[model samples]
Target: MPIAEVFLGAFLQVLFDRLASHELLKLAQHKGIDALLKNWEKKLTSIDQVLIDAEDRQLTGDRGVKLWLEDLRNLVYDMEDLLDELVTESAKNKSEAEPSKVPFLLPSCCFNLSSRAFMFDRKMRSKMEEMDNRLKDIITRKDIMRLTEYNGQRSAYRPQNLPFPTTHLTEELFIGRENKKMEILELLTGEEDDGTYMDIKKIPIVGMPGLGKTALAQQVFNDDRVANYFDVKAWACVSDDFDVFSITRSILETTNPQLARECKTLNSLQDELTKNLSGKKFLVVLDDLWDKNYENWIFLLKPFRSGVKGSKIIVTTRDREVASMVDAQLITLEVLTLDYCMELFAFHALGVRNFNHHPNLEVLGRKIVEKCKGLPLAVKALAGLLRTTNNPREWEDILNSKIWDIPEDRINVLPALKLSYLHLPSHLKRCFAYCAIFPKDYEIQRDELICWWIAEGLVEAKEAKNQWNAGLNYFNDLVQLILTWGSLRVITVIYL
Candidate 1:
């Protein structure tokens, strides 16, 4: 859809809200809709005449303003009975939620004034902004823009980006758990009907940190049924700060890269998104959520009310409380089973099936995998290291090491992975450590982080083809070493 379509959609919504508030039932019986329609027609005709004159003189100075007026007029004319029905339903719910006073209606006079001001070509952007401000003021007076209360209890964003499906036992690594995955899918995507609001399914996948929540989510995302079921699919990585703009951009980029490019702010991005998702069956996956506060989630999800029935919002989080707050049908993920664990282990270790050839290596490999204790990160990291070396001595040495013999905490691959970290240039080391400040799964901005690294004397500006190129290469090298992760653990510059 075009930008003109969005503006029109918003206008129709405003009109519908106004109509519903005016008590259409009473209007049809008393004032009569024919009279009301006539009134609207007369006002609209006058507005259209003014817009037509503005278009003729657009070459003088009003090109942008005239274009905006035309778009707004087109939007009003685009309103249909379908939109009126939705607004009526929403108004009924609103009235039930708060019944103490007479409902306030949207003012078309305000809209028309705004549209006319937008037609003034003398100060294009300023005039348009002024019109928007006026419109917001009217909406606020009507109590539609009231700020709701929110809680701020979480101290930090504990992001969990699991590298595997599960880690209960060896079987978990080898045999894929399609059945369990589906059970989780059913729980997360079940439909529920309540009389007041139209029924919609809400599924949430929750689990402990590093317990394969994200991996399981990936499986659901790629499932054939899910792909065909949802009309609109979007993925938002809600790491740490929960920057609305970045998440919205990620959603748009999932299916509409062009729209993502056109968005620069959260409001604009959301406006574009709401229009794209309206009346469509949408499946939105919000991954790595740490903010458990209900109010935050509600505000973010408000626009989703426009989505079609059966649309589901899948949230992957470590906090059960977050799942509850979002009113989601919960799928609590647990550790992988023994067999499944082994399968995942084998995937990382041999990189292929039929790994029974080397008797000695197979025995040692099983022992090594058992030591990993179903943690996919440990298995994958070890497998990646082992794949490069052909020496049996190296494998045996790894099996016999104190690092491998220590408790799980001491056996953390961070220390072994530190070998890769240690090899980095001094400047790159500082750059890598800078990543610690970010929450897990936080997408780091390329230019900004690089600039900080340069400012901190971590990267010499004179070392490369150009400062920008040097910064990019240094960032890329660190990413390749797994010192950071994103988009399948390959570093892509992200802002937020």
Candidate 2:
């Protein structure tokens, strides 16, 4: 037998031996419950302070902390066992004396002692839980707080909520995408229905930066068909680190707010998710998935598969590879067409009224919109940045500046985009990073050298604009390559 098992068995044997002897009850009766409890409380306080001091000593490894914690736990267990024995003895004595009703000797008691032990155990357990929670909070804060740098400005110091663009304001705001919406609908409905099991289709929406992939998914998420179809809906922003527990907690909070307190373990989380979703359809949207590992995807999806059928997993990412890796039936989102793009820009900038009637400003507005290309993200970003500005000169300057031409190393947004780029394996890296040179949203023919990439020797083919098959392969391959690489940008997708 394992040493741990042997030791545990021995510990229990010794415990039972002492309990049968009623040693705990005798000690409490001899020493007085109040005095004994006062001593135990002192010991507990001392142990807690010692643990805190040891933590401050900056122990090299967790071994010391683990050992100390284990000792404390063992102490608690022993105390609980002793209390149980005392309670049993007290009950036995009371039963034995019950027949002598005329004497009814005062059942003078270890009741206070037993109560104190129970209270002590409760406090100890609470403290342990609080300590564990504090440690997790520290780790999470370390990870998240690194995202922003303190600039010593009051404006920066202000605690601001996510003020990024929303789906409502964007033109592509579920603008006119029916086919993709239907695909999502089919996954949630259709003949694939299992009586209880939900076939989790992790559909990854992959596209380049500024593509309205997230916007499209968000639209579908809020669609009346989707809302009506899934009985339970939970949305979580799974940024880079992808803490399973945190995400689970967020979903639990969203799906059934009261159960958040009950979710303490992964198993509990799974149980809660299953219990809430059983016999009821559900939709879970994991936005901004950055992790590429199948394990990461599987770990989260495993529980959902057991959910009621027609339950769906929709993930939006810039990396098509992530989509493919997760077996997401790829919904490739392309940049808006010229007409759609112009319409979106006019809607945002001119606010539904036609600005084209104004000769001079119309020309200037068109120039500004053209500079943003057909990319809704960039247009929306520029629009929000310029929303308060009515200055014609500022608009012209923004239009004239080569913001798109900003060097890869200099732009904050470029580096954020590059984070996903840098994480790709070498072969994939060479294929993807090569596409960085293409003008934003430039629709080079699929076979057209993937033009920039071919010249860069990232791919083997030369430009063949007329060969549809070759173009398709090249386009699909490049699309696959980029989507696989993933997007690092943090901007929430919003349609204007």
Best by lDDT: 1
Model 2 spans > 4 angstroms off:
1-179, 192-194, 408-496
Q: Report, for all candidates in order, the number of backbone clashes.
A: 23, 12
* Model 2 global lDDT (CA atoms, 0 to 1): 0.51
Q: Assess the local accuracy of residue 232 in candidate 2 as a C-alpha lDDT between 0 and 100.
A: 81
Number of the top candidate by TM-score?
Answer: 1
lDDT of each: 0.52, 0.51
Per-residue CA lDDT of model 2 for 1-496, tens digit only, reads: 1111101211232323343344554545543453444455444444432332232221223344445444444654556555565556555555332222221112324223344444543454455445445434433433442322222211101111323343222233344355776776676556355577635656777777677766677777777777776788778777666788878877778678878777778889877876666676778888877788888777877567667667777887777777788775688777666566666655655455346654556666677667655666665545433444456665664564333354544454532132222222233334343344454334345445455444433343334453334434445543532332223222211000
Candidate 1 per-residue lDDT over residues 116-157, each given as its tens digit? 332421233243335445444433332331212213211111
